[model samples]
Target: MKVEKNISLLPYNTFGIDAKADLFIEYYSLDELRQVLKEHKGERILHIGQGSNLLFTRDFNGIILHSGMARARFLDDETVEAQNGLRLDDLIAQLTDMCYCGMEKLSLIPGEVGASAVQNVGAYGVEAKDVILRVNTLDVETLEERVFTNEECRFGYRDSAFKHELKGKYIVTSVVYRVKPGDATKTREEIIETRNGKLPKIGEVGSAGSFFMNPFVPEEQANALLAQYPDMPHFETPQGVKIPAAWLIEQCGWKGKTLGGAQVWPKQALVIVNANHATAEDIIALAAHISQSVKEKFNITIIPEVNYI
Candidate 1:
């Protein structure tokens, strides 16, 4: 276990916020994590992953916990278990190199293995829920290990139970993902190239990959909108008609637009980038304006996917 006091969170979050935490701990084993939890009982605690999807609004007056255990192993012919601290994209790269095809579509997505299930992260028609077999977590109160099946996770579009009823009650320790033997090099490379071209590179440019969740509307409303925007792109799903938030933001002339030190990514309007040392308030204000414009022009509400802390 490693402990630090009055730590700057600038190195922790991808947004590059310089927030400070009263206490920060990184545990390398399950026992270490349990010990820290017991020692800091009743104190404010926040568990973070790669910090790719977080926005630190200000200094945190609490304990920040992180996992240092990074490892992965094949459990069976069809499953692989990975530690929570392992990078999600690194795992996908390894799987693809080993001729595993199931996760290639998710290549290049930023975050850790633990956040994959919590966020139900997806790209190019493939979601982490589609490949996840089960999740292993530690109950915060008892420090006991528990396994949740895929069905029990109750995954939805970019969400799962971990973000709701079970939030803060359990800390994910590892995740088991389904895989198969097949060459996925071409697909993985293609995904990596495409994502690199549009999304801002992590560590180089400060931005959450995608800032807004794609809004879904009733079929009737979608039809009405289509009559007005013949060029609008949309998709039909069981839940409703899915409209890409990128398209809406672009239509509102947000692409390449700047507010304060933040700017809407020119290549992909769905992303908000800290192009000029943007503060959290700058990013938040820019997103609010974008959302407001979309709501006013299209009567659609687009919510941020980034978690503000």
Candidate 2:
């Protein structure tokens, strides 16, 4: 266990907000994590992986626990297990290079392996839930270990039991994934090229990827919007029709719109970039502005996918 005081969180979070945590601790193994839980029994803790899907609204007044485990091993020819702290993209690269086929579409998504399960991160029709075999975790309060089957996670669109019924109750330690054997190098290259075209380069702009979940509305409501705008794009889900937030934001004329130092990414309206050292307040204000506009125009509520701290 390594504990630091009053740590600057700018490099830790993808948003690049310079928020400070009252205390920051990192552990490398499950045993160490158990010790941490035992020691900081009553301290408020925010457990994170890479902090890619998080936005710090203000300096955190509690301890922030992170994992430093990146070791991985194969259970078999088709099954691989990785510690929670491994960068998600790094794991993907290794799998693809070894000719694994299942993770190609999800390549380059910013986050760590543990977050992949927590958020059910997805892209190009593949979600982490699809390939996950098992999740290993420890109860925060009891420091007891439990293994959750994939079905137990109860993954939904950008959500899982971890974000709801089980929120703050467990710390994910590692994950096991079942993958197929085949080369996907070409697919990975194409995905990288496409992402580069749509998203800002990592060092160039700071963002939390897509800012909002595509709002799902009933068929009738979706039809009404399509009646108004014939060219709008949508997809059908089991629950309802999902509307593209970018299309709605663009229609509202918010593309490239600025609030303080935040701007809607010109290339992708769904992303809010730190255009000029934007504070967390700036991003929050801009997000509110965008949400309000979309509501007024389409009568739908688009909620943020990013976890605000």
Go through the candidates in order and give each one's C-alpha lDDT: 0.94, 0.91
What TM-score goes with each of the models?
0.99, 0.98
Measured with C-alpha atoms, the lDDT of residue 167 in candidate 2 is 91
Model 2: worst 10 consecutive residues (lDDT sum):
196-205
Q: Using alpha carbons, what is the TM-score of model 2? A: 0.98
Q: Write the per-residue lDDT of candidate 2 for residues 111-178, one digit (tens) a residue.
A: 88989999999999999999999999899988898999999999999999999989999888899998
The stretch of ten residues in a row with the least summed lDDT in candidate 1 is: 92-101
Best by TM-score: 1
Query: Across residues 91-207, which tens digit of lDDT does each residue of candidate 1 receive?
Result: 988888788879989999999999999999999999999999999999999989999999999999999999999999999999999999999999888888999898999889998
lDDT of 1 at 291: 99
